[model samples]
Structures are given as C-alpha cells and as structure tokens.
Target: MENPFGAQTDSESGSAKSYALMTARGPQNCIESLHHPRPRAATRAGRSGVQSDYGSSKNLETKTPNSCPRKPTRFLTALSWQYPNEGVIKINTDGCRKGEDGHITARGVLRDSSGQWMRGFAVNLGIGQVLEVELWGIYLGLKIAWDIGCSSAVVLESDSATAVHLLNKNVEHFHPLATMLWGCQDYINKNWVCSIHHVYRECNMVADKVAELSSCLELGLSTFQDPSDSIRSFLSEGLLGVCRP
Candidate 1:
C-alpha cells in the first residue's frame, strides 16, 4: 500500500509506520513518564523579531512544544452532569481541607441573570474530612438560595462527586456535614424547585479555585461581602456559557 501523503509504497512490507501526532490532556502535571517534550525551541533567527512571548510559531514552539495546551476543561467538567438550562437558577459550591495543620474551609458563590453576583461566603470549618468540607459548601449555597429567594432552581452542582452523592442519598445518619442535609432538605421542602448534580472540578472550576483559596491565609478570608478572587478564574474559563435562563 502507498501513503498518498508521501512517496512510501510498500505493499508487501511486514511492519507499518504511523505518523499521527498525539497531544497530552488533563492537568498540566498529569502526564508522566513522557519526557519533557517542549515544542521546537526558538531558532536564533526566529527569536530576533518577536516582541511578545508568543508572537510567532517558533516562539510558541520554544515555549510549550510538547505541552498539551487545550482550552481550560471546564466545559468537560460541566458536561459531566448532563445538566441543562431552562428558566432555572444554578449554583456552584466548593470545599477544601488541609492535611498538615488540620485546617478546613468551605466557600460558596452564587449568581443570577445579568452576570450579577448573588452571594459569596466562607466558613471556618475547623478540622474535617474533604468530603465533609465539600458537603458544607453545597449546604451553604442552598441556604443562600433560600435567603435570596431564588425560585425554581434546577441544579445544585459540586466538584466533588463523593460529597454530591452523600448529599442526594438515603443516609442513615449525618456525617460531619449532617446538619447541611437538614438545611438542604428544609429548603427543598419549602421550595421543592431544585435538584442536585455532580460537576467535575474542570466544570466546577470557580468553586474548586475558591475552595483551594481557603489555605491561603495571606489572601485573607472574606464573607458574602467579599468573595475570594477564585470566581474570576471560572468566568475567564467560560463555564457560564450554558448558564440557566
């Protein structure tokens, strides 16, 4: 068989050659064993005319040749739940825990139509498991929904599937986050217009970043009056493209 792209014509050859290029995926550090594949490095001549970090092909190749630079995977994250938007209010929640100092925190942020910030808040959860923290974040967000009077909410999404599962299950008793279920149930009982979903960290980008910020004491914690700058990353990644009506 002959390859039309090239002059190779070996019909009787025992082995075949493959030139399809494969790019990396997932987090920046997810790929291992593969060598540090950089893009083709800058030729001295190519670098001479470039004024910006990535103004030319050689400059880009020089910077990240082997890097799998896909767009931020928040769409991949949001798509996991198969959630749809139709005249519904959506909420995203996130939680975090530290291993060394036994510290934990949860932050929940909400928004409505018109790109307006509806609510943002953080709680010093003291010492708790990561799942408990995630559940707390979801619970807190639901409480906010009630306070703000959001009607007919469709999805309550979290980056942690384990926590989300615990949230929408038939638990015999409350974990560290049992009280949150009580609150969530109470809110649903009154409104009965909401549902739960498990969005991937990529989709729940804003919440994950906000939850990670719990460990950054230098950033200083704030309440609904002041959400940590984590949500900015989510918006920049374009997660709200399918936001509800």
Candidate 2:
C-alpha cells in the first residue's frame, strides 16, 4: 500500500511517489508535502476509506443546537474527528513554533476509544527543527506515562526517525535543544525504562496535527514556564475539539 504520509506525484501510487516533511521555519517543502496525504472525506476520495461524518448527531437525547454557533467540530487541529487511535489510548504528541520568529512548540494529546481525552501538553522549544519536534513528541509520551503512573507504554511513536533512533540507542545531542530533550528522556529513563517503539508518520496523526495546529494558533502557550497549564490546558482546550480514535 502507498504510504499515507505521502502522495504519488504521477497519479500512480508506485510511480516515483514523494513524501514531504514540514520545515520548522514555515510551510512544508513540496517534496515533504508529497509524502503524507491529508486525511480524506468518507469514500474513495479519502483513499483510506476511513471517513465519517462525526458531526452528525441524529439522536443524542440532549436537545441539539438548532445551528452550530461555531465550527461543526469536523476536525480542528486533528484534521479529522475520527482518528485511528482507539481503546489503545495512544498518546499523540507534536511540536510547534514558539515566539514571533516562529519557534516551535511541542504539543501532545492522549485519547481513548470512546473519544475520551486524558491529557495534552504544548511546549515551546527554542530550537526550530522537525527533529526536535519529533523528539518532543516522544518525550511527551513518556511524560504521560509518568503522569498516569504506568511502568511501561507500548505505543510510543514519532514522525522523525532521527529522534526515535537516538532514544533507541544513545547518541550525541548536537542541537541546542538537547538540554530540554534531556528532561523528557530522563522521564522515560526513570519511569518507563524500555518498550518505546518508533512508528511512522501515518500512525501518529493526532500528534502530527497537534503540532501543526499549535503552530497555526497564536495562543502563546508553552510548557517551560507553567507545565501544568501547558499540559492541562492543552488537554481541555485542544483535546476537546476534534479528536480521533
């Protein structure tokens, strides 16, 4: 099957397809954009056949609003109201820009099958790079483990292989953000010693979009100053929107 993270420039799935990764500075590069396809509407057009009208509430018993005063909850930062994370309770984490210069803030979300969200965090990082954002995703997952007092978690994923590999095997931290990353690494090392797996971008939809959405908003949200606010507020405000799985 073709990679969900990318699209085939030539219409054929196997025809010299390209995968695109967003740049820390701004929009994604054309080649990077080619790699991952946006979530689709229900039907073949979505291509994945994973589309549903989550907004439809035929009968909830509670008087439905005559008209949606705001967005129809189609999918804000998540891109889709229906996500792949089910009962598994996968924690999706992402990073975005921080200040005026567009410094990236690392954000994450935790959700279960019933669409219940447990937690979320948005950390503003001084370093602006995809690798760092990916690392932040991993760190946030580990932090969630510590929060829930879990000894180990099975579904730790990241879009960036560089960071995941670094965690898998100790490596030098060349970036300036290593200081911040170390805190997250320490949480995993001290709390959940092992069982961290590296997953592809396709599996990390929630976090990927969380990071993307954080970048889109001008919330001035950061974990460095007030972790509780960053993590807690992110969960309430961000997760309550259009979450998946």
Question: Whole-model Cα lDDT per candidate?
Answer: 0.48, 0.43
Per-candidate RMSD, Å: 26.1, 17.3
TM-scores for all candidates: the values are 0.56, 0.45
Poorly placed runs, candidate 1 (over 4 Å): 1-86, 113-116, 174-177, 216-222, 225-230, 239-245
Model 1, position 236: C-alpha lDDT score = 45
Worst 10 residues of 2 by lDDT: 12-21
lDDT of 1: 0.48
Candidate 1 lDDT over 1-245, as tens digits, reads 22111222222222101101111221112112223222221112311110111101111122333366763332211232122455556677788777886677777667654434555655555555677667657656776676566765545667676765554444444244444444454444454456666655555655666666565431112345433344554554443353221
Q: On residues 1-245, what C-alpha lDDT tens digit does candidate 2 reach at each position?
A: 32121212122222112111222423223212222122211122211111112221222233336686564534222222333334344555555555566566666666654445555555444445666566655655666546565454324445555565455433334534444344444554563333344444444555655565454332222222122322344344434443333
- Return the lDDT, model 1, position 156: 65
Any idea what lDDT model 2 has? 0.43
